[model samples]
Target chain A: MTLRELWFRLTYPLRQRRIARDLREEMSLHVELRAQELLSRGDVPDATDASLAARRQFGNATRIEGAARDAWGWHWLDGFRQDLRYVLRQLAHAPLFAVITMATIAVGIAVNAAAFTFYDAIVLKPLSVRDPGSVVRVVQDARITAPDVLPFSAYDALRKQARTLASVVVTTPPQAFATILPGRSPDEPSIAAARFVSADFAPALGVGAAIGRWFGPDEDAAAVIDYGFWTRSLNADPTVIGRRMIVGGRSLTIVGVAPEQFAECTSRKPSYPRNVPHSHPP
Target chain B: MSQQTLAAVEREPIPPGTLDMLILKTLARTGSEQLHGFEIAETIRERSRSVLQVEEGSLYPALQRMLVKGWIAGEWGHTPERRRARYYRITAAGKRQLERELESYKRVSAAVALIIQSA
Candidate 1:
């Protein structure tokens, strides 16, 4: 369960009593006034018989109490239930009209839901990382294209100059390449893609390996294999770290394996890429 | 009560979903005077010329619903007859609802009458 749902469930018990008491008092007041009304009418001389007759004429107290309780429990939902019943009755009188109206409403809701889901997935959902709230993407406003990419030099300058940022890492656009395992045949290369990042990429993203350690500044020639790549190519071998692999005609040591959900960028890239630094760290 | 008196006093039951509107109309007519449950029922009965008696069962439930919906507000007060009672007053929402319901009812009844007269 989500933390919010758990918290609500934990706190709900404290408020339930107050809600029940308020409902009881409201219903009790209604019954009391009703009895008084019956007594005032003076049809029956005895107060007890008059009150009883009034209640009987009013109908089942328990059933009305239950209905009122349901309203209190979920007010909007109860109203919706009543409205739905009314609509169904009307629809029963005119089946064709009901069909047409229901179809129109269904299509409208489906289209709206689909659009909202797409927008939520692409724009609203936060990145899957620790402290995602603190992570901010740097975009530069170029004269040609608004909010264009920041140059590596500018990024480096920001990394050095900015005091507010705990850490900043630059990620280069993904490039397609071929991988060749060291000691394997040269003709047996596997096609892959890679995204070059700065030394603090993993730390800045606040992610750690599921197995083995992340690359340090000195490990410029190291590569981190994502869980998907590790499972698909290396068969998820526990001892796959320290192995050497060649990508883009460069040999690198496998230092770590990223968690399954970790994607280097939030872009809609079909293939996950191994994260490596651009050239070597300064 | 005699059979003729009983027959005269009794009328068709009020249709469902219209009780709240009728109660709201009754309260609105009272202009600033908060009416208790009995008084509201009596006002509706008298206005309808004793043809519509608001029973305790339906009246109280409708009142509760209206209170929950924020259409009307109620408070504990003493009746002019010196009895402790819960008096309900029409809120702005209740007034608006009464006007809307009254308009719709008029239109619907007119249409229904047209069909019935033709038949």
Candidate 2:
């Protein structure tokens, strides 16, 4: 990245070679002195014999050289490869232990991967927004046995009074709803789960429609179809926007089409249409 | 007894992996005097009163490792007999490692001694 780092990387091998040469020379000198010591001590008479004896005492030269080179770093992968070979050799000797160890490791890895995927989907992954960290959920702690619910009055009060929140929108829990296209098969209506929200919901989530535009405050009876529903049911008609669709017996205009992966407020559910009315129960 | 068995019974070998620490200790004891591989082996053997004999096979490898670790520094020089040799002297890091190894060795050996005495 920098000139100094580039220089170091370029010159590293030369430095390593010098170190290796020095180590080999040092060991050679030691062996020579050892032979001389044997001669001086009268352990061996002939010069060649003493030198041979000293070489024998010094053990395998190639193995020691390999070990000395390993100490200079950059051989970590080689060390790991050697360890793997050793493990495979041992596994060849004991097949059952190897199988059980492999099975255990496989199971451990599968479980860990599954848990990490679940965590990433639910908690680690942020909502698709301009700044997901700035998004906050406002919950009313009723301190009762029932689940926490924000009353409509309280929602309105928070929306009006809260200075810290950039925007406030109220959404109902998702429930099953059916779509009724005009003059479609009367016997078979397309069914889907739907969520109702206030006018500020889409803006607060900080997502724009893939086609057309989000429903504004005046468009109370408008709906935005999800990308999947638009493609699968409407055959991805380009002029689907401004088309009229009856949802729950109420004729509503399709104002926009949400992105394919944009599951409103959650990842697990399919990307279904969201209706933003002027006044909605919290 | 066979000659090999007799030799094995004659003197105990220095324990494995402690050769580096012992070499550092020897260099520290000699202070400024740098020791060649042979002298280091001899000093270790003598200091242990000949009870511990450092095999030439292990000594060279240990020295090579210590050199790479930068615990000890080596340079080509002449021995007392005017023989060319690579003399090694302990660095500051080597002295610190020697102190740590000595402390741990003392504690472990003491614990072993206590257990043996109780048994």
Candidate 3:
């Protein structure tokens, strides 16, 4: 390309027309400079004649524009800002409608916030897993298709086949009705909840035992209860880790206690002693 | 009386044609070197001192718009005066647009002037 064409192509992507105007002005200056140089050397009447001659060598402006647009993609942000400003103006005009819409949005936001807070506290937050983004729950194919919980054999198979997962832990939660020693009435039974989980349960979520070590692998007779469990049921004993308690017709040694914030899964499932016969054969 | 119409006039939208041209020329003169939002606005103001005046609020929106269009690039960095600022640089494509626009605008304006004078 010639010098003028080359300059046009170089500045094509610059969206500001003023920049183009400045460039054109700069080019015109250069043309005048060259023309004056020719005139001083006794070439012609003035720079205008020299510029006309220069223009003959310089290609058509239309071709240069086409090439510039083809080379540099369209700039659309200016139009978008224009549209946004227009919308903001329109929204500002109708105060009553805007207030009503905002009120509806505010109500919706509050409800969502409350529900999420409850979910994060009770269901989602307690898992002490390493990089929760990498963790996946092992649900049965049948459960995914329908809404039923996984059976014992399916859970076992899922654990065996999904080797890509970091770890697999299961929980069978149960609700218990127990009598507390010190109450307003002094002989009232309190409602409590508990879930039975594998030894790797706490380790899967990266949560450590608040007191002693959690039940070691292959130690089914031991149980790691929550801090609330010891405080409310066992009277907050300092040395409760070695103590045994009868829960759901089975005696379980309190091997360790979890922090108050940590909790195991509480969803309905088989093998939950009070709920159903879902335990696998030992 | 609702002040909405008055507010709209007070904060009129920057015409797309003008904004695009301003960004292109700003980048072309400054080169694709990194420039903060304030510096870019200042540069445009100084360059068009005789013709036009650009406000900071309008400049920022135009800069943002340019970034979204990918015509120019920007990044957060410390200014020479030691303030946190967003610096912008012109792309190769922006330079080409400046030249094309200058040619088209001059031609169109000249033609319009000729028509007006003849009539």
**Per-model DockQ against the true two-chain complex:** 0.15, 0.21, 0.02
Q: What are the chain A TM-scores of the candidates, in order?
A: 0.53, 0.64, 0.46
Q: For each candidate, what is chain B's TM-score?
A: 0.90, 0.89, 0.70
- Tens-digit per-residue lDDT, A14-104, candidate 1: 6656545654554555555666665676556767876676566667766765565443345466579899999889999999998999999
| Candidate 1 TM-score restricted to chain A | 0.53
Pick out the ten consecutive residues of candidate 3 chain A with the lowest summed lDDT. A269-278
Q: What would the DockQ be for model 2?
A: 0.21
Estimate, for each residue in A1-282, the C-alpha lDDT of model 3 and write its tens digit: 446445544565565474445334333433444455456765557667866654442335334333333333343554677899997888799988888989999999999999988787657763454466777665546745643355567767766787687676666535563523222243454555556666576667676767877766677766676666667666777676676555544556666777655543332321111211224522
lDDT of 3 at A41: 61
- Candidate 1 residue pairs that clash: none
lDDT of each: 0.72, 0.76, 0.56
Model with the higher DockQ, candidate 1 or 3: 1
Model 2 C-alpha lDDT per residue in residues A1-282, reported as the tens digit of each score: 436435544454679777667667767877888788777877787799889988887888778877766555557766788999998999999999989999999999999999998788777777776688898877655575234356778788888899998888777666677777645765677776666777777778877888987888877677787777678778888687887877776788888888754754465433344556546562
B92-112 per-residue lDDT for model 3 (tens digits): 666766678788877987999
Q: Distance (Å) between predicted and true CA of A132, model 1? A: 20
- Pick out the ten consecutive residues of candidate 1 chain A with the lowest summed lDDT: A264-273
- What digit string (tens of lDDT, one per residue) describes model 1 on residues B1-119? 12345575666567776798899988998888888776787688789888876766677667766765667888777766565667789988778879999999889889999999999
